[model samples]
Target: MIDAINRKIIAALQQNARISYAELGKKVHLSAPAVAERIRKLESAGIITGYSVKVDLDKLGYPILAMVQCKVYRAKEREFKALLLSYDEVIECINVTGEQAFLVKLAVESLSQLDAILEAFIDLSDTNTMMILSTPVDRALPETFIK
Candidate 1:
């Protein structure tokens, strides 16, 4: 149901969520009130889900970022997911297709901590982990689709 103006608003908000309504209005050629109304409608329609802040995990003492692909036993999927939910270190867990059932992203202070976390999952799943060296393209969404 999004029109060209709404698409522009979404694109602008994606770049900077903290943008003032008045400033955003200027960008989309609308009044502040109109901009606010459109944003509210977007939220009500469940398009604009939530806003978040990006943080430096390394500075926060979680220097190690690892991607753990887990091939969970069919009977143990629920148990494996329950364990994943308990850990604060688990930043993202995606249920995906392939040899792996779950792709988990973990941030930890050290290799020892990472090992301990992996040990907990070994009973229910076989894991293949890769430490992230650098993220050249992090969370890049297509602007072409928006336009």
Candidate 2:
């Protein structure tokens, strides 16, 4: 179970993952070695999964953000999953229990790219496309319930 100190460390990491152990120790009021040991323990327990960099998709030449919702027929679940896995544009695919079977997040350069992706999906399964108008807020919520 995470204690108060571990929670502080996790919060700090979430804010700035590149913060050195010495700096984190200063923030959390622990020695550098102690903070290191705590972080190691968190990793061993699977509480701290990994770190990643947040990139600007548009600046990176990915000017399109589309959420493709698919209402796949029950008969083609395996095939659909395999097709999605093969598509590099698919950032994430989630299965939902409502009218839509899966919601896919795709990043691309233009409508032509989206059209190509949609054509592939339409040939494989029934899908509905919804272009993202704007992302007002998109940020990770803290894993504050770890304790």
Candidate 3:
């Protein structure tokens, strides 16, 4: 179970995953080894999943970002998922309840590229897509949960 110290560690790591254990320990008022042990425990308990890097899609030549909501028939769900897994342009995909079966985020260099990616899904799902203008709030997670 996570305590207040763990919450602080999680918050610091979320902001910068590359923070050294010694530095992190200083922030949490623990020794470097203690901090390392706590982090190891968190990892073992699956509380700490993995670290990732944030990249600029525009700088990478993928300026267009689109959120595509797919209404895939139950019978074609597996095929649709398989096709989605094959596309490197797909940034994220989530299955949800309601009118839409899956929400897919795609990053591409041009409108034509986005169109081609969308076309592949046409046979499997009815899709509604919106180009992302600007993300005012990106990925933000609560450091501590209220019980």
Give the alpha-carbon lDDT of every model: 0.92, 0.88, 0.92
Q: Please give the clash total of every predicted structure, in order.
A: 0, 0, 0
Clashing pairs in 2: none
Give a tens-digit lDDT track for model 3, residues 1-147: 688899999888988999999999999999999999999999999889999999999999999999999999779989999999999999899999987879999999999999999999999999999999999988547774511
Off by over 4 Å in 1: none
lDDT of 1: 0.92
| Candidate 1 displacement at residue 109 in angstroms | 0.3
The sequence of per-residue lDDT tens digits that candidate 1 reaches over residues 62-147 is 99999999999879998998999999999999999897979999999999999999999999999999999999997635556764
TM-score versus the correct structure, for each prediction: 0.96, 0.92, 0.96
Please list all clashing residue pairs in model 3, or write none if there are none: none
